[model samples]
Target: MILERHGLGWAGLAIGLIAPFFIATPYALNLMTTAAIFVMLAVGLNIVVGYCGLLDLGYAAFFAVGAYTSGILSTELGLPLIATVPAVLVVTVLAGLVIGGPTLRLRSDYLAIVTLGFGEIIRIVATNLDITGGPSGIFGIPGLFGDALSGPVALYYMVVVTAAIAVVLAARLGRSRLGRAWRFIREDEDAAEASGVRTYRVKMAAYVAGAVWGGLAGVLFAAQLSAISPAGFTFLHSALVLMAVVLGGMGSTPGVVLGAVVISLLPEALRGLADGRYFVFGILLIVMMLIRPQGLWPYRSREHGTSTPQEAREPERARMEGTL
Candidate 1:
């Protein structure tokens, strides 16, 4: 099963590598790059919402934190885009601790409401801050690869590689012992606590992991646009990321990636409909929910020590022969 999964991943990577050959247009590359970044965001959120069962409605806050941190550092200090990653990581980790430390204690609706508020606060602060360039946002941010290979195609390839790595890492984490702890908490926090799992610490770890992923994606976003703005990190943005996780099947890595790609590209694919595209999109989403409430790719656990159908039937057959 692991080999099969890895084969699928390699196949996906091969497709991404050759995509430019078929549709090398700048617009196409830019859109594909954005979709890849969305995939990263969705996967990150999956760690919190999918694996850990934390309902976070303000995930975009971390994204903003990373983007603003990287943008401000690069634009103001004249640092290269790559150099700001360490700072972005630090700031995002702090943001996770500060936010998750207090909020993780609350469950369900309360946690969601608080996270929503935090997302709004981050956006408002960015709008009001001079360093963030107020409503206009920070502009002229540096590119990811600098002048070494400064082209849309090169940037697209770079973003794809980074997104791919993020997905793989998240998948690996989901299979680790820490991941099992997360699932335990998700299914029943009280039970997880009784099992000697430190639920609080485990939850915090998931939040911090998710925040780091979002932050890194933010750096890519800033590099792609060469700008960072309050408008980009809104409540709607957070909702969309959450939607991708839900629609893709929470806890299912491939599902989340597929969900993100569909969400990101569907609108553009419907450009012919123009003004009515969103309306149609809404209808499609509604239809999808009705058809597959479980999600496009729901996660299924592989149970240990489960008897095969044939094996079970053999026992039944023996019993029947003895009775006869």
Candidate 2:
């Protein structure tokens, strides 16, 4: 399964890398670039929601953190946007800990509510901050490259390559020891704890990882648009990221990527009927959910040996009993 998945991923990457050759229009490039950025966000959020079973309604807060941090640093210090990436990472990781450390203890709907509030708080704070340019936000930012004319095209390719690498890395993480721990916690936190997994620590790690991914995406966003405001990072953005995860098959990498592309491009595709685009979008989401709530690419866990928990633990329990 893993090998097959990788093969498909590589094929997709190849297609993405060469897609510009076939469709070089500016509109096409812009749409593809946007979809790639959206894919990064969805993949990151999947680590929280899919891998760790954490409902993070405020995932966009981390996105905001990265964007604002990078924007402030670059604009204030006369630094290049790329130069602020390290600072962005540090800020995002800290933000994750600050938020996840306290709130990850909550379960299900409670966690969702708190995250929702956190998302709102980040947006509101950005809205009021003078450095963030208040409601008007920041503009006149430099592009990723020195040349403005070629910057968009270069950035588009950069985003595609980066997104492809990120997807592969995320998949690799999902197959690692830490990934297994996340699955255990997702399956049953109590069981994972009983098995000696540090549930809180593991959850925090997932949250932080997700934050880093989101923050990086934000940096790309700031570079691409060369401007940003509080309005760009809102509950709606968080909800859409979550929707991509759910719509794509939460734990499935390929699924989430597909879902992000669909969500990002569906509106553009429907723009011909400007008045009814949103309505059509809503109907499509409803139909997809109703028809395949599990998602377009549901996760399929590998087969495990059929050893009962008690049987697997019997030797340890017996040894401990004898020692006692």
Number of clashing pairs per prediction, in order = 0, 0
Whole-model lDDT, model 2: 0.83
Candidate 2 versus the native: TM-score? Answer: 0.91
lDDT of 2 by residue, 4-67 (tens): 3667777888888888889858888888999999999999999999888899999899989988
Looking at model 1, residue 113 earns an lDDT score of 99
At residue 276, what lDDT does model 1 achieve? 100
The model with the greatest lDDT is 1
Displacement of residue 286 (Cα, Å) in model 1 is 1.1
> Per-residue lDDT tens digits of candidate 1, residues 1-324?
121275776887799889999995789889999999999999999999998899999999999999999999998898878889999999999999999999999999999999999999999999998888999999898787566666888888989999998998999898777877777677667766765777899999999999999999999999999988899999999999999999988887887888999999998999999899999998999899899887887765533322222232333233323332
Cα lDDT listed for each candidate: 0.86, 0.83
Total clashes in model 2, counting residue pairs 3 or more apart in sequence or in different chains: 0
